[model samples]
Target: MKKKTPGDVFDLHQKIQSELNAQEEKQRSALRRSLSETKAAFDFFTDLGHDSTTAIALTDIALANVLEE
Candidate 1:
């Protein structure tokens, strides 16, 4: 096998980092979408002053606790 040069190692490192950055950007975008949806739902429930609003609040708390654990 041929020995790798410094430029080859640098190129490979840069490629891997670029892929990781792209993946992270996609995840951040998805999270933003989910957050917008959740906010809309919360506003709907809150404006109506329905019991479901309480449930939503509780569910949010539960999810927060689970994620912390």
Candidate 2:
């Protein structure tokens, strides 16, 4: 078996950190997309004469359900 050096350990740590950062960014992107879509849906319903308060309440419920997942 090959003995690992300090440089190898550092490189492995960097790789893991990079992977974690990428995953976090992906999650943030997904959250942004969900929020944008929710806004669009809310606007569509409001344009069709839905009450703003009711729409907001429903949007909040929907977002809560989504975040719970």
Predictions in order: lDDT: 0.80, 0.88
Model 1, poorest ten-residue lDDT window? 58-67
The model with the greatest lDDT is 2
RMSD of each: 4.7, 2.9
Off by over 4 Å in 2: 57-69
Q: Write the per-residue lDDT of candidate 2 for residues 1-69, one digit (tens) a residue.
A: 999999999999999999999999999999999889899878877887879998887778777887799
Candidate number of the best TM-score? 2
Model 1 agreement with the true structure over 2-65: per-residue lDDT tens digits: 9999999999999999999999999999999878867676667667775875858955765577
Give the local distance difference test score of model 1: 0.80
Q: What is the TM-score of each predicted model, taking all chains together?
A: 0.69, 0.76
